[model samples]
Target: MEKRLSHVDDNNTPAMVNVSTKQTTLRTAKARSIIAVNDEILALIENGDIQSKKGPVFHTAIIAGTMGAKKAGDLIPLCHPIGMESCDISIEVIESKIVIYCTCSVTAKTGIEMEALTGASVAALTIYDMCKALSHNIVIEETRLISKTGGKKDYYHE
Candidate 1:
């Protein structure tokens, strides 16, 4: 069989994938995002988190990232709305880069890769938003899926 875009119909109209026929299983996905900050922002980092005027940077990002994962279906067109089991966001500072990881799990007919990706992306954005006042040079370097499981196949990034 040939592989094609799952969210497009034979008539070339965009549509949500019909996951009702798919088997319900425990699906999980992990995604990563990297944010690069300048020395000014790095200087303010006291511990694992940064204190911003908006509040604790990492703490606010954790809440926002979790919300983003739960709301990915609403944000992205043609994505299935899933009742996710859990969403975890972890952040760490390494050198001048801040690394974020979001892991999402769901027991449903479809996988949760989008949720994981959205979570990581939002967390990275949140970090940028919180720290932009110090310097406009902050950059969200990359956002990508690290791994996914419990679908037609599984994947892991190198």
Candidate 2:
């Protein structure tokens, strides 16, 4: 069968996909966000996290990312509300960029890709918000799904 956008109706109006009949299964997804920082921002990093006037940048981002993942359904109109079984956020500095990875898992009818993506994006934003005082030049380069498994198909990129 030809694939169509799940979030659209016959009239081409936006709609939420109905997952009611779909069988429940374990679903998981991972997403990545990369933020480029200048040397001034990098200098603030110590002991696995950056300390700003607000708090530990990496630690706060982790918490915020998990919350974002849980709230994805409320934030995105088409997304189905999912009670996530687990959410993990990891942050690392490589070269001049801050790399964030968000992994989410759930037992549900739909995949957990959106939650992971939202988590990573929010984590990157939290980092920017915390470090903005030091430099506005901080760049959030990209947020993309790294992998997803469940439902009809599985996907992975590098």
Candidate 3:
């Protein structure tokens, strides 16, 4: 097995990977986040009663997710700054939980998995922020990369 270390030095100092020699490819990644909310909040969403003092919940989250994907490198240390070609965010309410999916693509030397993950996570946080007044029992259950393609190796969730 090969160890994928971020740093080439034994000290493991923080540094960005040099991808100048790597081939540029069309890379895409999809990630998802599940946020579990209380029944009261779910009821509000189902009833379409999102007229809180904070404004619409789902719409705002979608916008925030897109912005977050573009700024992923600024938020995450050691992540290569990437200019995403496109970012799409979608949210679906399932029973008492909300599912957020963010897909990002770029033609570059690096993959966009971090951008996708960041987008979903920020969107989940935005949802929590918007709905916290209704209930504080919200839980960001999980955030994971669903798939990645066009890199040296392709990855998919099993």
C-alpha RMSD of candidate 3: 1.6
lDDT of 1 by residue, 86-138 (tens): 99999999899999999999999999999999999999899899998899999
Candidate 3 global CA lDDT score: 0.91
Candidate 2 stretches with Cα past 4 Å from truth are none
Following a full C-alpha superposition, what root-mean-square deviation does model 1 have from the true structure? Answer: 0.7
Q: How much is 130 displaced in model 3, in angstroms?
A: 0.7
Give TM-scores for every candidate, taking all chains together and pairing residue i with residue i.
0.98, 0.98, 0.93
Report lDDT per candidate.
Answer: 0.94, 0.96, 0.91
**Which candidate number has the best lDDT?**
2
How much does candidate 1 score in TM-score? 0.98
Once model 3 is optimally superposed onto the true structure by TM-score, how far is the C-alpha of residue 65 displaced, in angstroms? 0.7
Model 3 residue runs over 4 Å out of place are 8-11, 46-49
